[model samples]
Target: MSKTQKPVDELSAEEAADELAALAAEIARHDRLYHGDDAPEISDADYDALRLRNAAIEVKFPELVREDSPSRVVGAAPSGTFGQVVHAKPMLSLDNVFSDEDVTDFVASVRRFLAFPADRELAFTAEPKIDGLSMSLRYEGGRLVTAATRGDGTTGENVTANIRTIDEIPQTLPADAPDIVEVRGEVYMRRDDFIALNERMAETGRTFANPRNFAAGSLRQKDPEMTRSRPLKFFAYAWGETSAPLAETQFEAVRRLGSWGFRVNDHMAICRSVEEMLARYRAIEAERASLPYDIDGVVYKVDRLDLQERLGFRSRSPRWATAHKFPAEKATTVLNAIEIQVGRTGALTPVARLEPVTVGGVVVTNATLHNEDYIKGIGQNGQPIREGRDIRVGDTVLVQRAGDVIPQILDIVPEKRPADAEPYVFPDKCPACGSHAVREEGEAVRRCTGGLICPAQAVERLRHFVSRNAFDIEGLGEKQIEFFFNNEDPSLRIRSPAEIFTLKARQADSLTKLENIDGFGATSVKKLFAAIDGRREVPVSRFLFALGIRHIGETNAKRIARHYLSFEALRRGASEAEIPQGKGDPGNSAWQELVGINGIGAIVAEAAVEFFAEAHNREALDALLKEVTPVDEEPVGDVSSPVAGKTVVFTGALERMSRDEAKAMAERLGAKVAGSVSKKTDLVVAGPGAGSKLKQATDLGIEVIDEDQWFERVSG
Candidate 1:
């Protein structure tokens, strides 16, 4: 490890292979801790040093590139809780370069790929690489239908409901576009908001390790409102599956995306050459400290769309793009104070509000203090003080913020600590709820035991229930929900999920008071009522899931709805045997078992059982039912058409029904409509946007039906 070796005469083949293997394993372990657990054991400086060393090794010995090498990966595997979603196109990692020679080599490679002259000018787009999850937002006929997390390049979890809660994300794009398009972006927490959020989380006695972890956890939450309240921002960087052409160059594409209502990263450049690109990268690195949020690096893309297409992709990354990361940001500040904050869902977090100091050109006043174990350097052991320990008041702290975004304390200088300073202790009671906060067995988090009765818990829970991803009652958006609850008389507090139903009848004399609520307005109030009215009938799946039962999720709700078509049927059919039991109280095991059916796991079953068994929950359910009817699932044979229960596909120039119309028809007839063909695809619908799916269906010898054939089959 002490030997200094050059690229060409570095080491023997065996030595290189051994070192490469060692580096890959080390990086993967750190990646898991950082990305997966939010408990990184290394500083950004140290992590980059490791990454840079590994990349250099790979550059020297390309043969050492294993399939699982971190050098070739963009992100780690998706966290366990969220459902999986696949990308239409793989989300690939970008190549990296730190020096002028590397930039020149990249240009040379691009020129070779495009058969262009060295002197010929080429366009390029450069933007900050925000530190957050990569996601895809898909629109059908200009309306956002789904948003998905970029899971393993091939598949990802669907987060349509949570994405809808992001006010920055457009619900509808302009009508001039294609029938379908996928917009790609990063979801991040604003530095200021991240501080506020952690403060709230701490008060609730649930400590989040960092903003990125909190952001990811919030976005992947089964409940959409949980994501909504977290102040997440999105920056569009790429596009996928456009019906029409986007732009001539990558720069234009970003511009067009911004024009179409997507928030593009404000810091970007259109470089004409490698020199200009390098200069742009340097400029960004210099100002990184001034940015409001965290960015890991700067990204550079080959400008022309045609050139990009020609460069295509190599295994996991595109040859047309590379990330030019700055030599990470580091700073020092005095730890002013550590405080706890509660979240809308009652998660408590620890916040470190530091004495204002400039870091990487940005003013740094706050950093994440993490949890009690984290503060004590117990969670990650003796890893760097930056990745562990909670810096306390009067301690001299080293802070690091990459790209001026995510500010974190690197270490504590013991010499600066007051002699009387002691290890901080987390409170046993929720500051907001005054409830005994308990850290359940096997869980690191300490949550308020007040449940929904606690003031903070009550407000947060109600907010969660009315969120866009849950009941999605139109008039009851986040602002309205806040307005309705916050303005309620203290004596007549909106204490339960059932209480939301009584809002219309409650006394509110003026719109002024209502409008004065944190996020409400006149038109918004009207929209809220209309949305609430529109939700008089909701799908049984959504209705049940909206109850915010601890473990039951969207998928579980669907299974429960399919198993029992009506509320009465579910209530009567669920038995003790169906409940999934584990250690602890096991809640309502019998009721859990009844809804627990095949797909419902032990966790979900227990939550369902517990919810149904609770008398208060049952009364809330009754109240909800009075206002909204839950639609029963369509019976197996309800579609009386000839094509009923038959899988159908439409393909090649539709003469009759629009593809969406055709799919809807097939669904109505109880047939599953598929996007692509496999051994399982029954009928292939391939009218335009019909790319590889049509060919696959034909190759598989599956029935290939044109638009007319699709209409004829559905009509039959």
Candidate 2:
């Protein structure tokens, strides 16, 4: 169950910390799938909701903000397929505003930050927020030197060759342009072009999910010829790393880029007041469909360059600008049926099979039902949703493509429901393995108890083991894993992660060689073996995550791995740890140590202990361990630092930096920052309005210091 169901203010410090850690890991995974892989699982609305919730929690419990918070991250780390380019100026993202009130609050905050009088008119430049790949073109001495994609803000993938193929991008700027200017904009495909490209690719049994995906895929092509064939265009809206200022205002700067032969949006306007900005937003949103290319929203930026500089930036986005996203497009569709899909963790999720409908220009056939309660018209708080109208199989439902991505059922039309339609009876047994599917108290979904015996769970676990953040074996993709898992040949089939290591050996003794297979050539088989061999030695954190343990995501896995340092140590600790029966009950020394490791909560600790306690799990783990050696994490920061390996807690409002920033700084200085003060705490950083944590530190006789003193000691 998600911790976000409860109000942020109502959450305890421990609950807030756990939610923050989960959000960080979840957001990071989505970012990687969207930016790095060009495949996004959730809608932009869903993604935004997660970020908004994280922000809300952080606001309520400032000291509980984690080092890996989503606010501190921008885009995904660059895939190593292309040469990396570190930007001269970081390519930051823009914060989002969903409603008129949010926009008003943003403007009010900006005015407050600048100490500007309410009487004076503030100007903002509003433009269509194009949905495409962000690209940076660097020019030197009137010639385009390089082009790069926005890869994690700090560093980007060098796509100069593919970028040169786009006709809209200027090969050379005028002599009046700066000696070194990095023009930044979106590389997009027109709706007509996207449709035509899809039609062409359809004949070859391959098509892109959307125009944005097509544009991204086209731009990242290793072959320039392949990219040249695609109908891609560019629009200059911003600049990065300018040797000299382009203009005094944001609108003029974009206009200046247009003068240098770059295409600029014709709908760009300057709004003098909040009302005018809202009007502009409505006008743009109304004509969004008629636009040649796709745009998800309208971006509003501070008109004056001086004010923008004064406003500065947040951790990942600029403070002077925000994107007011368009509402989710809605459509009516027939609910054909509901199917249960068992995930890696064995949670049986109900998916709504809808009659095909178009929403936000994308074909929608499936929507998430969330769980049994959602279908039964129950909200997270046990309140009625859609006026307590439950959904039925033959009902006419209103479907919405939230944030122009994943479609979800909003409500059902009671009048249109078929007379024969019956209430969905959520299964009590696992559909795959016939094991009792149990819905534990406080959890929203029913989970299969079949565990390793369930084929669905086993396959999903195998997929997770070889996922990008896990072992990441090069030739072992999802399709290949599925193929090998169900292969008819005994020697070729791989039911577990340990079996993957035995494939080459098994194939060597088999009568039918792997190379003789339809899709496999001798060269391909050799490369696959080499790729599989490459992953024999993986980082311990990734190895633990690959195990697909509940509550143990990438962040928690790293925390556990770093604490244990080795797989044997972790296994021993988890095996010896005792699970507590109630709140505030310390189980054992191992359990206490696990729970006391800063961000590692009791839930995660219990999950680890439970997994280790299972004999089947331990046996499978031992078998896999024989085939792979998990490497320990190298020590980070200076080992000689005074706070190295010491647990420190911060209380109240920090003066110099945010709680996240402070925690990151402490980690860099080799200190482990804990959320609460305890006997294990080595030091405490106390700010104004210091609460129970401060008193606890004093009671424990732990050293306490102010923000300035912290800087002083860390600086040395």
Q: What are the RMSD figures for all models against the true structure?
A: 10.8, 15.8
Q: Can you write out model 2's per-residue Cα lDDT over 207-258, one digit (the tens) per residue?
A: 4656888889888765454577788999999999988999999999999999
Question: Which candidate number maximizes TM-score?
Answer: 2
Worst 10 residues of 1 by lDDT: 589-598
Candidate 2 vs. truth: CA RMSD?
A: 15.8
lDDT of candidate 1 vs native? 0.69
Q: How many clashes would you count in candidate 2?
A: 0
Where is model 2 more than 4 Å wrong at Cα? 1-126, 130-249, 254-328, 650-659, 675-709
TM-scores, one per candidate: 0.58, 0.61
Q: What is the lDDT of every predicted structure here?
A: 0.69, 0.85
Q: Name every residue pair that clashes in candidate 2.
A: none
- Residue 62 error, candidate 2, Å: 42
Residue range 323-357, candidate 1, lDDT tens digits: 87666567677887788766554566667988898
